[model samples]
Target chain A: MESLYLAWRYLVYHRFKTLLLVLSLTLLFFVPVGLRVLVQQTALELQRRAATTPLLVGAKGSSLDLVLSGLYFEGTRPEPLKGAEIERVQDSGLALAIPLHLGFEAQHHPIVGSTVEYLDFRALEIEVGRRFVFLGECVLGAAAAKELGLAPGSTLVSSPQNLFDLAGVYPLEMQVVGVLAPKGTPDDRAIFVDLKTAWVIEGLGHGHQDLSKDDAAAGVLKRKGSQITANASVREFQRITDENRDSFHFHGDRSAFPVTAILALPHDAKSKALLMGRFQSKDETSQIVVPSKILDQLMGTVFTVQDYIVAAVVLVGLSTLATAFLVFLLSWRLRRGEIETMVRIGASKGRIRALLLWELAFVLSLSVLLAAVLLLLTASQGGALLRHLLLT
Target chain B: MIRIQDLSYRYPEGGFRLLLPELDVARGEAVALIGPSGSGKTTLLRLISGILLPEAGRIHVGDQDVSSLSESERRAFRVAGIGLVFQEFELVEYLSILDNVLLPFRLHGRLRLRDADRERAAGTLQDLSLGDKMDRRPAHLSQGERQRVAIARALVTEAPLILADEPTGNLDPQTKGQVVELLRTKAGEAGATLLMVTHDHALLDLFGRVLEFGEEEGATTLVDREGAQ
Candidate 1:
């Protein structure tokens, strides 16, 4: 009790020095802990998303890119899979297949072209309004809705990926149908649309005039006062409602159209093995990748760098700890007179050492508390921090 | 009561040494040790308080052979049997004057803090004309006030022997006279054998006996005079 009182007095009397020591020690401990927590948490987050998605089938290049693009809705457009591939998976009875086409953005957020099965697979629930019922309607993810400040009945114009490719694609105006509730996932950052709406945005489907049928019987007539030519403007429906729903159609066999990737959910282990075998044909232009394994390998590369970085941080932390220890030693020398005084006043040598040790314990305990608070704050924002740092 | 026989001390790192053949102070006696700067006046007080162990001697404060005690035992013995008033008034500057006065009880550890202990501290401060200055730290007190606080600390525990080293060495004339009178009266009232080293000739009149140490090599030449003014 006497040691405690004396130590408290010293700390309070030299408060400025105590504060400096606490701040330095807190950062020294926090950096290594924060780095370790961030890496482990990021790996867990990425692995969770990847684990749910068993396999991704996409263009025959960077399997990591395919998985990242298909599962995470990130990266530039890879060579797209066809609607026929999705059909083949469905016909094979091997798995549930959801298609994703992401080569566009709206307000700097990814616009995902997928099927209604995508919503079911992700377990997304609408927080407001209804799901898309027309070709040009899109639903906003929770973060997207909040960031764009859009709700049901609002208009969202898809941002064309390439301005110079205006002939092939243009900014298509989409009708906001609903907003998804916050899921704290990557899905929260995307705008989801039906595959047909994605095709309209890609200029592969549209409402246009039948040039050969300038016949009055078909309701094709020249504007009475305006000049008309063989090339009549094909009216691309900017907004889709019940009236213009029939006008939007793909020009060719829609089954042959493009999709970014096919997310395959194999029914059983046997079917997964069988499906893996089927995609192994040498003539195949696509490859099947297990998303979890791909993400693990991707994280392995990151971990190598992280290991070196953590080692460096550990070295710095150790240096700081050594400096603090040295400071403690110096302070002990400085307080020799005080120690001698206490001893002369009938305090045992053990009591003097205990008093100093109690002071140390108090400071270190405070530093540990600071480190814990910092770690929790970082953990709470781990997803957003990782998204900002790596995903974009 | 205190007794020393063939007491000798040598500094381990230096060549300073002092050997006294014999010295004795009876119970309830007030003795003043007067000496030149290097005559071991303060050293004898430290030896009596067990702050320094004699190389070859037996020094007893009451019945205990303090010279034979271990380092820690000596500390306990000092806390239980001896009170020290240092020349420099070694008060912990961070603590309030009351805490400084009660320092012996705090470090003793066997003594529990009580209202009575606080009252004793207040009473000691009151005797020293510092009743209202309990909350002020040493840095806030005047030199004479700090000396009184140091005296209060040494006396608060009511130890049997009180050894003071130049207790009034730094005080002005009027404060020195008042401080020595208080020390003499209190030690007599408590019946604690008092031994103080003083350079002030005027204060020596208050002591019952005076022993003077001259500038001599390795010797505490006793020049004793008994007549308490």
Candidate 2:
């Protein structure tokens, strides 16, 4: 006990040296453990979301990009599949098709245009107001709502694809009707609207003033027996409301409209295999992908990279530990006079050894405790941090 | 308090030897030893305090046979029965003056530290005019004050014998005299036998007798206060 007391006093007297040693040891212990915990948590989060999503159908291109864009609403927007694919999947009776129209942004948040079934498929519940019920209405994810500081009755304007293109996609103002509850997933960072609204934002659908009205006669370019054509002076309705909602219409064949992907949920194993086999033909323009399989490949690469990182951290930790040992040894050398003094004063050999050992034990114990606390923080919050990193 | 008969010691490297025929000091005697450098004045103090064992003969301090005791036993005896004061003070710089004084009790398992021991240490520093400086480290003290702290450490043990080797060697002339006088007074007040080695002849008057070592053959001659050898 007395030896411990002396050791404590020695450490307290040289507090700066003690603090430096402790911080070095803390990093040495914390880095590898914290890295492992974060990687494991990221893997688990990715796997959980991917496991819940049965399959993804999109244009014939990068399966990984399609999965990432369809599931996470992140990364490159894949080549789009036609809206007719949803009808084909529905007619097959092998799966339920949920169409996704992606590739638009509102306030930097991805605008995910899907049917109401998409929300039910993902088990998303509204936290405020109600879901989008009109063509120009949007529902914000919890994170998006908090980020844009918008609630029900607030307005959000879609960002124009190109600021300088006068005839390009125009910014359409949409009304915020609801906010979704947070699920700690990518869904929490997206803005959801009806599929037609996304097409409207893409300049594929629009509303315009009625050229048949008597007040708009000068703007009409030509008039046939039962049809009329208007020039550029005609005003296009940028917002859809009760009075102008009926004016919003699509110009082309509706079945040919583009959707980024379709989430296919089959009834059983046979149904899933049949649906997967249907797109296996080389002549098929679209590909069907199992999300879990793609995610498994992704996690495999992540684990390999994590292994290298952990190895590097261990090597660095070993060197740091060696340096810490050298520091303690040099410190012991500097304290030779003090040790000699203690010896001459009748301090026993056992007591002297105990004093040194106790000091080392104190430093080690403190480093371990601090490292544990940091690892706990990483374990608890690492998923959310990883999600934010992957999304942005 | 100390007895040596026909004692002989030689350094292992072989240049010097100490041969003492006979020596005796009564309990409570304050004696001074003077010699030239390497004349074995400090060596004799080490021999009597059991810090060094003679090559030939026996040494007795109080009732214990110091030269015959084993190494561990000798260390226990040294910590419990002899108070040592060194020229450099040798106080642990990290410890305060009071902890330095209380150090002996903490070193050996035989001595259990108590509240009374703390009070006695405090009192010893108080008597040395260091009551207010108990919490100060040795580095913060002047040379005389540091030496006094060493003296307080030696006195706090309440040992039967006090062996000081040039306790004032590093002090100024005025501080040297004052330190020697304080050591003598403290040893007398505690009833401890004082055997101090010094090269300073002026302070010999403070002791009952002075033994001066001869440079030729390590022989010693006793000189009383009248300067008669």
- Residues A142-257 of candidate 2: C-alpha lDDT, one tens digit per residue: 99999999999999999998889987898999999999999988898899999999999998899988888988887899999878988989889889898899999999898999
Lowest summed lDDT across 10 adjacent residues in model 2 chain A is found at A383-392
The TM-scores, one per candidate, come to 0.77, 0.85
In model 1, the clashing pairs are: none
Give lDDT for model 1. 0.85
Off by over 4 Å in 2: A103-110, A140-176, A200-258, A283-285, A386-392, B119-137, B215-229
Model 2 clashing residue pairs (backbone):
none
**DockQ of each model vs. true complex:** 0.52, 0.56
Per-residue lDDT tens digits for candidate 1, residues A175-273, read 998999998888998999998889888888876543344442244345444443333344556666677677677778888899999989899999899
Q: Which numbered prediction scores highest in lDDT against the true structure?
A: 2
CA-lDDT, candidates in order: 0.85, 0.89
